[model samples]
Target: MSPRFQCKQRGAIGLMAVGVLAVVLAFTLLVVDTGRLYLEKRKLQGVADTAALEAVSRNGTCLAGLSAATYAGQSVARNHFVVGNGNTLVTQCGAVTTAASGQRTFSANPALSSAIQVVASKTVTTSVAGGIWSLFSGNSVSLNTVLTATAVAAKPTPTLAQLSIKSTLASVDTANASLLNGLFSGFLGGNVSLTVAGWNGLLNTNISLLSYLDQLAINLGVSAGNYTQLLSTNVTASQLVQAAITVLTANGATADVLTALGNLKVAAISQAPLTLGKILQLQTGTTAAALNANLQVFQLIQGVVQLSSNQSAASATLPVSVLGLANITTQIKVIEPPQLSAIGDPALAVANPLGPNAIYVRTAQVRTQVTVSLPVLNSLSGLTTAVNNLVGPLTPVLSGLLSLNLVTTINSTLCLLGAGCQQLDLLVLPGNLPLNIVLDAGGASSYVTAYSCPTGSAGTKSVTAHTTTSLASLNVGNITHAFSSTQPMSVAPMPLVDLGIQTCHKILGIGSCDPRVPFGAGGIAIQVQSNIAGSNSIQDLVFSSTTPFATPPNVGLASTYQAAAPATNLVSGLSTALNGVSITAYQPSGGNPLGALAPTVVALLGSVSAIVTPVVDNLLAPLLNPILNNLLNMLGISLANVNVGANLTCGQTGEAYLVI
Candidate 1:
């Protein structure tokens, strides 16, 4: 052969080899792309699952975990290729408006009582593969996919838990619905009970109504001395009665009587009363007439304290038999709030201006709460109906997935969805198609709240309710207590907000100010808070100012949580565990899911008075009731079981007694 002929033969062989290599390269690229698409789909499903769970959790809502997950998924999808979609082609990412980071959304119908619905979609394009594929196939290759998942999750119920209220309280106290069973049936103790009624279904920020009560307790410690002094000097029990009677008999014209009554130094009195007890300090100057009048005054005080002055005063006519007390005037000012506002400057007052010495006492309070257990009364009752109803709507779609062996994958994806997916993808080339996702969920629960008043020292019957509010920004876990201001803090109040995403709470620390908050009402005084640090609790906040000194909160958490301390003197340190309520949760047989949880929480509390509050009958009974019985016995006052039908007198005006 000639040289030219040999050269031509070599060229032909080279062309054939190049063509063969091209085919191999194409096949390899297809396999690699297929594997990548599979991996992307799995990863997208995971991101979607995580997003849904975060959305379902209460903390995630606050921390915006779902949104974060969506953002993360979008960022990841940017690395995938966009393939031209076809009937047989699979998607890597779902049909998304844009492949931007975090802008997509997945949501469940809150209206559904049971199931969690999720819809996740994103658009991804292979930056390299599409151009190369276009060069060879004369077509652009991109990936587009839509993914959705749904879950019928069990609601989180706070029932079924064995609760223990380690308190000295006599009965269950349902102060706020988030903390009690109200029936007392769930409670276990020597003789603990509960009274659930009239719940304020509003709990925002750290201060539920019950939490507000404890906060007030701290404030009380600050102003207790001044109020005690005010009690002693303002007017003696007898003096007040005499002044009122004098004004009454004179047809409400005796200004001098009014002035004298108002001017009487509460500092001079040693005892006062609710029904039978005298909350005053009688001296040698205390006369027989004064004592007699004091008894009447005590009766009036009881009526004034117990009844909610929040409403119009009742005009009941008690038959005037044995110096009856009637038509007592009452007034009240409350700092009750549902949620603390953060729109204004952080330095404005959130509570009424309080004096360092002139503390406000809980005159009378009736708190109640309800805790609906998990898997409560009828958790599964409507299940059959709901499932049957879904059959018609889901049949066609489910049949398709099953026929294509999609059940294992699609159904699994559905189960994986916790609440709602924020991001999900199948990694298919860019395509335009509508995906339908439908979900329905249902659940049941019971919730209740209950409360009692602060009992006072020396047998006083007071059910006092006092509360105040301040402004602060709370993150996922922590909370800050600033002065009476409405400004946003430089930092998040809770750790969850600061921690980025996906975290649980260890403690719901209630706060009115920072821990190092200055005591007293000098500059929105910060009382040393409990459930966090040191203790300096006193026996009772209601005490005589001149008796001695060592302010608490000079207040303490002694008013909120408690445990029996017979072995240790609780009054000595800030460790007086004497609060009255506890909570527990129950789960339906299936699982624990918060949204489905109705009365998920069961709170245990004590309302029966013994010896803590001090408004006598107004704000406290535990302390006031005992004192009343003891004092009346000492003073020769007695109960009359005169069951004269409608015109009956059970006991003394302010005294509590069994009318047999």
Candidate 2:
């Protein structure tokens, strides 16, 4: 019983041992082969990633001479991944598009190469498990299998471009300084006093945009390097000024400039909160390095102050005085704030320079209204005498043109008594009359229309911008209501004179005359309305290496609106307006009383135009021309000309990162 049982148990134990050995060998091969494949895959993935990143970082393109494939091959070689030795590396150029939901998609485009894609593959022996299956099934399966790894890399930041708009005012004089002070004071709702030197310092000084933003971020307690948030954040005018002061102080600005800035800061306290994005526009995904451009201190301050003013209820009052006029009040309001500088992707801007998403900048749009109280004719003995001498001879002619019995009736009825006689008096311009002159200046605008960065040299970089100069309109009349920044101002005929009667009462043996009463109901109101057309034009601004981001170049754009042939005869428009004076006759209630006297009134106006034109020209030319020109210059607005500046940096080489 024992011998046969022992023999069977030994055989069974040997069979079990052989089976366990085979299973252990198979499991070991599977583990080793799988681990080797995994390691190879990992290595291949590393090579592909490195190749893609190198291709993009080197600015590789699919265009003719330098190809992304060539760059990727070099990177693969450096990584020790040999090609054609059971290993292959393929590269393709493409662009990365990001959706609004933050989803990224890659599209292969040979024409555009914003990103590079690399595929690395190696042919390796089939897995042990498959080999075993093939052996069991008696089928001839392939020995080698392809293992591929793919990677896509692109520039972390986009191609950045910056444009700056500067004021045409290169230097400041005492007169300009005074005007600037009055303007800024009016905008800030406080007093702003700066000397000519101080203003000139601001105009000449330049501030680094990056440094200013950095300091501003720090002051605002925003996270470092978060320029997008900093730009969109709401900040007070004082904060913006202080940030500029800090940057200027670090750059060692003149004491006068700093002091002036300090004064401006104090004045800016009354201003409302505003975002820097209004004045300085930065497109989405703009890199921090692109903000290294420079900005003029005057332009920056002016833009910020203008933005503040646009949001505030305050209006600027210009300190100007015209001869022969009393209570001269001038008010200026900003209709739209200026976009002083912009940084963005040139590719996006190229589609439409003035589109909502494009990189564009513009000067402030402003409206200036001047109200002048006409001199009291009776009070001014000399002016009254002069006016009487000029218009007294035309009274009989005016009576004939009016077709009224004003002279006869007054001579017969009033002079019949000779005790309390009433006399008809001809007043050219009555007292407490207002003469309003409104000037609306549309600011200039500039935007990047096209740009190119040559593959090889940075010197050949070129950027083009389309600029449109300002268009302005002028109106001379009487406006009853206050000026508005948002709504358009309407002009009504300005009352120039009153043809009326004066009644005298016998008192203490002396003839005393009451205030002059208008004829018919009161008097005839002679009003004049004048309008001047605005001129604007479009031009191209080409920037080259000479106008780099460090130093911007300015170009003056002359308006297409020709001001007479001589160009200096700006008063010719006034003359034209005065030539077309319209005489209006009003009855006691409302309607015009003179039904058929329009043609006669026109003839009368022709006669009176010669005399009134000179007086008006003399009175207004000296007063309005200087004020308008000086105000326009200081406000960065012009009817005849505009100054625009431009700066462009194609893009900087940034770190490459995987996008897909």
Candidate 3:
């Protein structure tokens, strides 16, 4: 009885031991399988990261607008897990986007087109868990675990490194509102009015060049391709205006840009990169930079145009004596025509400069008309009663009023058709009394050249271009004066003023007596002529990019602007036009009684001319020169001294990074 019971107990104990061993073996197999799956997943992640990086490192360009980077990434991921089954991989040239539903999605956005996304998946077949599940459930189960890995990478590029600014000399003068108004009206095809503060706001504002590009890219719905994208996008005038407005507002600018912005139509399309660097005209480098600044060439031009267009015509009243008689008031007016286009191209020279500026400004043509009235009847009225006291009896004499009118005008044009050239003309005319007088001055032609430096340093500065003003021409009535291109301005026989006189003899017992007067000594003439004949030279100014400022108002890259020394001869010529003035009195040959009074008349007229000289030489000439100079300065083609402004630097290599 004991032996049988002992055997049964031993069998039962053995079965329990075998069953526990099987369970331990199964658990070990499951652990090993789970570890293998984890290891493979980690390996896949590494492969995906490496593949994405490799794809981005290669040029992203592909045929048919397809992403070569995508194919490259897929090939790399597949190579890394060639031994795995159910292997799947996908690569795309896009970035991850999140939806409102908390889901992640990849979309083809141009801004993120440079990035590469690589995803890889592999299936791991189960060894023990699959069998156990099948045995228990009596059905085939997929013990195949799927592992996925994803990565994103981008390529490196080059960008702007530093910036310098060229110096500039600018002044504000609203006295010539007519000229401003005309110019503005022509540009906008309508009237505009801007206050001094408004003009200052535009002129004083600065923008970040790099930031501007980024804004433009955003507006155009394109990606900022390390600044290269600027070359591919074309913005219309209105679009450009909007983009500029964005920059100005972003910088908290206070300029009144709405008028110009609203007036701008689709007259032109502006390209980037070259257009941005058009003023500097750098021959080397890709012209693609991420340099940021407060102001740029185009922005400055736009500001100026907007400011001018928003102003009304210029007008003013001045008082002056006429022929040393009664004081009279004179009115002056100046008008400026609007420009059709003022855009620019970086690839063009100063004349062409990639493309023509949006607006082409011309010299303001000034027209002046002067009228003089004399009180001849008042003097005769008192003397009429005293006629009987003289040796001869006189009758009641009739008195007549006399008036004189004179007109003068000046005009000029420069740099037409992107030729970087200039030309000018002037004309003057005296009233229709019995004398003819005329005065004219100005050059026939002028050419300009522009310059730039690679590093934007001082020593690298040079004459980017040069200009040649053709021989100047001067004329006075019948006389013609010519000046060579190399000679200073000079004109001969510049007839200035002329007057006619008459005399009459009284007869006794008659109501009125009249006598004929010869046309000889009774006339007055004044003129100025120049003898100096030599060529003149005028220098144009150019500016360079400037360093950034640390303050709020000037917190941007500035430029160093250097103006060419103005040709002293131009000033000298102006002085010459006013110098060498002379007054002349001619003698009569006929039996005219007025001949006897020529000497006394000459003395009186000489004194009158002397007074007029101060008004013309000191007041008119001085005032006119500054106005013309201002016009030239506003054109940005010439400068009187060196000026510096905020600017941004460019031309440096840059690396890309993973955004996600």
Better of 1 and 2 by TM-score: 2
Q: Model 2: per-residue lDDT, tens digit, 522-549? A: 3333344545432556777676555544
Cα lDDT of all candidates, in order? 0.23, 0.70, 0.40
Every model: Cα RMSD to truth: 43.1, 14.9, 15.5
The TM-scores of all predictions, comma-separated, are 0.19, 0.63, 0.43
Q: Over all chains combined, what TM-score does candidate 1 have?
A: 0.19
Residue 335's lDDT within candidate 2 is 82
- Give the C-alpha lDDT of model 1: 0.23
**Which candidate leads in TM-score?**
2
lDDT of 3: 0.40
